[model samples]
Target: MTDTAIQTRQREIASEHLLFKLIEYVEDRHPGLLDFLEQSLDHLGDPADDASKDDAGVRAIAQRMITGARRQGTD
Candidate 1:
């Protein structure tokens, strides 16, 4: 595989690991947190079409925000 493909696969693995860990943590400590998050998103209304256009960029921004919030002791 090319270097880019290798790096992309690594990133996908890392993201999946992070997601699993997050769900586990939330389930163990904050019960219903995931449901609340889903509801919050629904409240924002649907943007499925627009989201597909730049989903990666949106996810990257969300990851950064979550990381920053954790670093600041806000989450």
Candidate 2:
């Protein structure tokens, strides 16, 4: 494959792996957290945007997930 093709394929694979990891993390920890993340990611205008909105959304989700996981652990 050409370099461009290879890069495209690599990006596709990486996105797939990231999605899988997110799913596994949610399933094994917080059941509905993936949906929350998806909602946040979907509302963003651009993935490359530097508006800080994406970071804020992701951080909020991460905090919620962490709190849920910790509560589960202590239960």
- Find the candidate with the highest TM-score and give its number: 1
lDDT of model number 2: 0.60
lDDT of 1 by residue, 1-75 (tens): 999999999998899667756765765577665455544442343347753565556555555544543444313
TM-scores for the candidates? 0.47, 0.39
Error of 1 at 35 (Å): 0.3
Quote the lDDT for 3 in model 2: 100
Q: Which 10 consecutive residues of model 1 have the lowest summed lDDT?
A: 38-47
Where does candidate 1 stray beyond 4 Å? 43-75
